[model samples]
Target: MADPLDLFLAAPPGLEPWLAEELRELGYAPQTTAGGVTVSGTWSDVWRLNLECRGATRVLARIAEFRAFHLAQLDKRARKVAWGDVLRADRPVKIEATCRKSKIYHAGAASERIARAIQEELGAPVSDDAALTLKVRIDDNNVQVSVDTSGEALYKRGHKEWVGKAPLRETMAALLLRAAGFNGKMPVVDPMCGSGTFVLEAAGMAGGWQPGRDRAFAFEHLANFDAGAVSDLRRLDGGTSLHFRGSDRDAGAIRGATANAERADLTQATQFDMAPVSDFAPPEGPPGLVMCNPPYGARIGNRKPLFALYGALGETLKTRFAGWRVGIVTSDGGLAKATGLSLTESAPIAHGSLRVKLYTAQL
Candidate 1:
């Protein structure tokens, strides 16, 4: 067994507490810190986090940390750190560097030096297209090198090829679901579900499915990757009896969401329909939660008509979804309030270029 690596799981700003809570539930004692959660674990823990964690944007494993006043010092210190234990000697790798408040402030120079050291010491080919990356950070003359264990971010999930305008990312949806207190025991409905991210994510959790089960990770290319061992971490609990439902006004969105659900193998537990907010009908069972990432007018459309849309959505939820909770994600607070729902506000979070927040209320 290799020594425990310093694993930093990056979550969207304002969501570190929830991510830490999730890690505690997953049996890891994580120290919640600004920007990410820090946990010490081995290669298997890295693999499992990349596989099961739905809220983490990137799972970074710190391989080396040392002080280097200059590039030559940096190169010497970098070469002394163990690389063969975690990285493959024959595999291609990429280097990314960031420098702040350090004597060796040239990020590019630091990356080049480290890359050269890795190639000369470990005989690894470095390239831009490599699946493995060594993230170098220099701050206050202290250098830290970590690897992005999760490639293409955790939200890609490999099943959602089709997307709608201002589509909700899978990671944000999962965090929102967790924020909304969804335990996967009851039903979930999304009236304005773009590509069915919230619905599908909720359904997968309800079914005890691994978020990364169908995806490929950058850690698979590392030297310590154990395919047989990681395979055992997958959830074999089968599907859940609870249902998840999504409705979109656009017919194309409905079709795309259904196909995406099928691709995720979640068709048995989810439903998608081409229906507007006015047509929302609670499922046969008990009321669960109504969550939606509506059109946030950041990249797509105007905000005028969306006021009516929000109002209609609020009216429908208020009249139809009694005893059910509601969650909405949007950048404009005015639009969220336009729904006429008494929602509790969360701190602003970064989504794309716009700042958004999750509004929660009981309907």
Candidate 2:
């Protein structure tokens, strides 16, 4: 039988279809559900998904799934499974448990039970920042246990060392690029490219680069996984040369982005400049994507100036970027409306604890 793999993708409310399509593009025809998608593949395909997928927050491998009515039964089943095949005795692991309408409704108690079982029976260490994590969800007396294969949330990318205040995450940036219909063929302009996350992610995608190429994943510690096979699969090179551009009024932000690009070995693929929004322009193309996460007054502490900034942004897009697509990530709806551009679609997304909306405009 093929090595069964279950993938979990966390999306904004009403973005499961987008995630499913992203998976399909990666050669996994995922079955869509209320909050996530499920797919079956081998270990090779699992590595590919972890490397290539930009829309997913985490990818998990379902190791065991069964029904349990009590904590004793859960512990018995968890211990009965061949833990040696999946977890190394020396490597540390954390257990996160959630109970919903189940007999064992105490999440903490259940997590403790599992942790004790893994440690006492299997000799694995317990930790919170473990490279590997076990996720257990008990719903209606049915238990599903899975191991997180993607370590460090896949957005770390191991490239960005400096981040500005309220910086957009790499995963969110990639999804916004896709939502804006950006194929990475044209020059992408970020007027307020704080830390240059969008620009770098676009450059990587344009070059067909894998996100996990330089990072280590939790699944590598699993006994069933073959290190040589994973290395061989990742040996395929993503060819070179990409066109991406980012600009910010802050000279420091530009410098940070340049340094980050150099660290990611993508300096040749992206260019960073220090320029104000009023001076921003599309680079000789009608098909480029203009994406920005401007100051929203909550973290930046200046609402009045932000309105002017949004207005200036709207004026720029309306005057210079005809036929180009625009995407704005902002938490303030009023400030976004100040842009005065016709919005085509707006979707709610969570960025940390504060919920934000992604607005799309066509010019």
Candidate 3:
């Protein structure tokens, strides 16, 4: 049998449980951490994770891990790894190293040593624009080396070509939908809907679209990966269609959302409108989900006016969206409280440098 896959999925801080649950739904047992999750699978499974997983920032395949006391031992172990089996000599590769509380504390030297070994011993061409990236981390006297399987961050999705200021990432949007218990059978509305990220993600989920279908991953450059299998998997049918709706007061945001939805082939699945939150109307459904990433005061121009915006949002939700589930992503807890809804649960999630929280409520 093929060697078991040692996969590590890095997430924004405080999102480990969300990533873990997502992986479990994909038929893997993931061990959660403060920064990420660790799991085991095959090469095909790794492809699936890169293509299907929406909550992960990057998917890494652990190649080697050992205890190293000094630079000589680190170099010897790094050189002995079966790089030929995993990496193609025809493709250029780059190594990034990090050291913490280790005898060999110089990360740059370690990276240079590994690069030299790959170039001199394995005859591999090293390039700055290498498609494949190897990451080395020395923590607690243990050296861990991993290969990045996803070329670009999974959040890119290749569909959203336009974005508003402080737009939410596609992966974080998808996770927020999942956290809100959105199964795509009901309508979803985003009142603030900047660049329509949340709404588009909902539409994709409702339409049974795979996030990575149109993207390229780093594993395609590996020597042992089967290109045919990857192509076949992408061709697999995703069977589901559900209603999705989005409205924003900004006309520019609406136009961007329209174009982005078209790029994702989701125009048929999503409906976008130019309307302010006060004029927003809930879609025709029993009890669906309403998710929004409103402008936080830090990025936007004013803070005092935003409080009124949040209050208006709360009023609208209470008056219009009875029985609907609500999820709001925000960095300001006080502003979140302006909604005046009884929060069912709230969990912290990292948004770049800011630690934002997803506040959810059921009307």
Candidate 4:
């Protein structure tokens, strides 16, 4: 058996606890930290996390660590580490460095030393646009090396193409759905759905599908990659009976969401319609989760008219969507309060450049 390794899962700034909870539920002991969660496991666990995790934005495999006081010592220590075990000779690599409160605080010198070490020791060429990325951090003179096993990101689930204005990321949408007490047993409705991210993710979870099934990861370029073992980890989930639904005022957004759902093979489970929030109505079934990522003033148009829009949404849900739960994501708390629903604000989450919160309530 391979020796255990320290793996770090990076989440959005304020979403570490949620990511930690998600990892713990996946049968891993997660240690929550300032920016991310650290879990220990073998190589297969690293691959599995990259393949299965929906809440994580990126997975970094901690390879080695040592204390170095100066640039020469940092180079000496970096040369002793095993680089060939993680990197391939044919595939190029990119190195990023960070430093804080350390004697060897120069990020450029640290990065160059490590890059030279990799070239001389492992014969792997270094390039800016490489497939693999190695991150070096020298905090308090402690040199730590990590390889980014996730290439692009977990949110680029390799299916979405037509994105509406300021589309909600897949990772945040999944985390929001989880926070709203959704377990995929009941139905899901997004009235102001931009590109149907929440609806599609709900369907994927219900069908036991892997989010990274369609994407290529940086782990495939590692030395220990096993084709047969990875094949076992790939799961193409079957169709689900529980229908997930979404609607948008923009007909183009509705068409794009439908195309994306079709590409993800979730057309049967997810349906998108071109309708405004005033015409929103519950599907013919038991009450379920009513969630939407509505427009905030940050990216879209003016916020003056949004009060009426929010009031209309709240009134529609209040009169028609009885006994159903609601979650609205917006950066402005006042607009969320304008809904007039008794909602509990989830902890602020890092969305693009602003911090956004999810306002949820049971009606």
Highest-TM-score candidate: 4
Model 3 ranges with Cα > 4 A deviation: 236-239
In order, the Cα lDDT scores of the candidates are 0.89, 0.81, 0.84, 0.89
Query: After TM-score superposition, what is the CA distance of residue 93 in candidate 3 from its true location, in Å?
Result: 1.0
Residue 120 miss distance in model 3 (angstroms):
1.8
Candidate 1 lDDT over 124-210, as tens digits, reads 999989988989999999988999999889998989988988787888788888888788788999998779999999998888788
Residue 98 lDDT, candidate 3, scale 0-100: 98
Worst 10 contiguous positions by lDDT, candidate 3: 235-244
> On residues 1-363, what C-alpha lDDT tens digit does candidate 2 reach at each position?
126656666655446666787788777778887666778887777777777787777788877777889989988877777777788999999999999999999999889888888998889998998878999999998888888888778888877998987888887788778877777676677889989999988888788778777777888878777888777767334544546788999999999999998888888878899999989887754568898889887778869878899999999899988988888988899998999998765666667777777789878
Off by over 4 Å in 4: none
Q: In model 1, which regions exceed 4 Å deviation?
A: none
Q: How would you encode candidate 3's per-residue C-alpha lDDT over 91-135 as one tens digit per residue?
A: 899888999998989999888878887877677887768989999
Against the hidden reference, what TM-scores do the models get?
0.97, 0.93, 0.96, 0.98
Clashes of 3: 0
Whole-model alpha-carbon lDDT for candidate 2: 0.81
| Predicted structure 2, TM vs. truth | 0.93
Each model's number of backbone clashes?
A: 0, 1, 0, 0
lDDT of 1 at 268: 93
Worst 10 residues of 2 by lDDT: 233-242
